[model samples]
Target: MDDVTRFLAEQQYVELTTFRRSGAGVPTPVWVAPDGDDLLVVTVDGTGKTKRLAHTDRVELRPCSVRGEVAPEAPRYAGRARVERDAASVARVKRAIGAKYGWWYRALTVVEPVLERLPGRRPRAAVVITDVVPLDS
Candidate 1:
């Protein structure tokens, strides 16, 4: 496996940093799964990172703690991200995530729909990131 895929496979959470119009980086912790040569992340559709990615595909990924804390010595990978809205693509990503995360993934599937029905809850979407390049390269 390539470095990016290997790193992601060993990590439970990754810090996905998306750029804002002002060139600021917003980092969020997300569950990630290997998808062929790419990585997939499922997140709320209308989140800032999702909106920012729409304008700019440039993104950075690094193994991180569940709370978004980055390990100082971890390598960072760069890639272009695209949101996936189609049902088939979304289902594919969902299955990948579920397989990787197991019970936690199952629990989320059970709880997310109820959470979405609550006031102020946002719908979820999947993002596929391609052309990942290690920053050291």
Candidate 2:
């Protein structure tokens, strides 16, 4: 595994910073798991992070609090992110997340089917972060 991927995979929460069209970075806390050398993040299909990705793949990532707060000393990494909406990819990410997060994730999985019945619930997509490297300090 790449150092960046291994490091972030061990973290409980990750602050995924996606870039706006204007180049501003929007950071969101997300559950992530390691998929080989890449980092996998699952999110709603139409979320801002996914929308932003349509315009740019450039992103920064850092270990952070569950609420998205990055500590002063956290290491940051830069990478290319791609949102995958295919069933296989989505399923793979969900499995990875469920394995890492355990019971809480299992509970979510149980509830997910019911939630999907909602009138307009967005489908989940998997965001794969690749080519990651530590940002220069």
Candidate 3:
């Protein structure tokens, strides 16, 4: 988690690719924040991603070019992810976001609740972690 934590803290955005039920894949643009040793994202339940995450706890998060552009051939970094339910953990994640992105965090605080109440918005917390199994190099 150390390397991941550092990578995420420095990267502003990541392309989150999740598995779809139809044996396909879904790629989404997400604004991520650090959550201790994991990356945190707040999304509503019952969405396509929510369901997919429920079925499989794996996802790929790739750090894009700092210029805010990505090529079609970018290779994503892979990891396993899961839903986090603890209140303390949630608060920690929120604080991390606030610390990293100041003004944006303040702005989100105002709209977060409204977004949470939107239809199909479940406000679930996701934590992506690297697999412990070593890769052959």
Candidate 4:
């Protein structure tokens, strides 16, 4: 595995910063899994990050706490992200995330169907980030 993949795989959460139209950084904590040399993150289809990603593929990732606090010594990784809306692709990403996250992931899968039925609760989708480059800290 490359340095970026290896470094990220050890962390439980990543601060995924997507850009707004005005070039503002909006960072959110997300669960991530290694997909070959790339990274996969699952998020609600209607989230701001998802919408932002549609207009821009640029993204930055770094190790962070579960609440989105950036680690002081973590290196930033730059990459291009694309949404995966296909069922098969999303399922594949979900499996990888579930395997990495274990019981918590499994529990979420159990509740997701019910959660999706609520008003304004859109289905979840996966974002695949590739061509990751570690930026100098």
Candidate 5:
């Protein structure tokens, strides 16, 4: 694995900053799984981050605490984000998340279908990030 991929794969959380059409950044701490040279983040459909991605692919990422706190010296990277909505790809990402996160993610997968039936409870999808490049912190 490359330095960036190795570093990222070791992280439990990453602050994913997705850009809005108005040029504002909305950062959220997310579970990330390395897929070859790329990264995948699974999130609920119709979220602000996913919605922003439909407008543009611009994104930034950095290691962060589970609560979304970024360390002062955390390295940052820029990349393009794509929302993957197809069933096969989303299923693959869910498996990746379950492998990395174990019980919590796996449990959610079991209940997700039922939960998604609730009002405003959307289905999950994967956000694939590519062309990652290190940026000055």
Candidate 6:
């Protein structure tokens, strides 16, 4: 990761803005962590955000303050996110995010263990790794 990518990954949270099927905007708060040279974001498969990403890989991710307020006119980073479905990668990514964020992510882990041996209650999907190329590229 370059300076810009590294800096963006270090932020507490990122605004993941995707386009709705109706050509409207749908933004959500995403927990992201750096994966060597890419950004990894976690989400379920049946979500609207996932469907939107399938239609258009293009997305805007902006680093926000800890208080969750972004500067009114701050510059946002532009990139495309390719959804990944690898088990190992997803586990590693989740751990990284939890470690960096500390408490909140840890809570999620407590609620849902990565390796669940339950018979009928398994997670359908893990996480989506978004390999980002700067907009200027």
Cα RMSDs, all models: 1.8, 0.9, 3.7, 1.4, 1.5, 3.4
Q: Model 6 over residues 1-137: C-alpha lDDT tens digits? A: 77666977887787777887777877777778877777777765567777787788777877766545677765577777765557875677777787778898887678565455565554534444355545544
Among these predictions, the greatest lDDT belongs to 2
lDDT by residue (tens digit), candidate 5, 1-137: 57887788789999999997889899999999887887888888899998999999999999999999999989999999899999998988887778889998777678667887898777888899888889984
**Higher-TM-score candidate of 1 and 3:** 1
Model 4 over residues 18-43: C-alpha lDDT tens digits? 99999998999999998888789988
For residues 70-113, could you state the per-residue lDDT of candidate 1 as single tens digits?
Answer: 87888998889999877788888888899899999998688776
TM-scores for all predictions: 0.90, 0.96, 0.72, 0.92, 0.92, 0.77
Instruction: List candidate 2 segments past 4 Å from native.
Output: none
Q: In candidate 2, how many clashes are counted?
A: 0
lDDT of 3 by residue, 22-112 (tens): 6676877666776556677655445677778888877776666544455665545767777665666566667776788889878868877
Clashing pairs in 5: none
Candidate 3 displacement at residue 78 in angstroms? 0.7
Q: After superposition, how far is residue 101 of candidate 1 from its true place, in Å?
A: 0.2
**What C-alpha root-mean-square deviation, in Å, does candidate 3 show against the real structure?**
3.7
Which of 2 and 5 is ahead in lDDT? 2
Clashes of each: 0, 0, 4, 0, 0, 0
- Of 2 and 5, the candidate ranking higher by TM-score: 2
Alpha carbon deviation, residue 105, candidate 5 (Å): 1.4
Tell me the whole-model lDDT of each prediction, alpha carbons only.
Answer: 0.86, 0.93, 0.65, 0.88, 0.88, 0.69
lDDT of 5: 0.88
How good is model 5 by TM-score? 0.92
Candidate 1 is scored at a TM of 0.90
Best by TM-score: 2
Residue 46 lDDT (model 5): 91
Which residue pairs does candidate 2 place in steric collision?
Answer: none
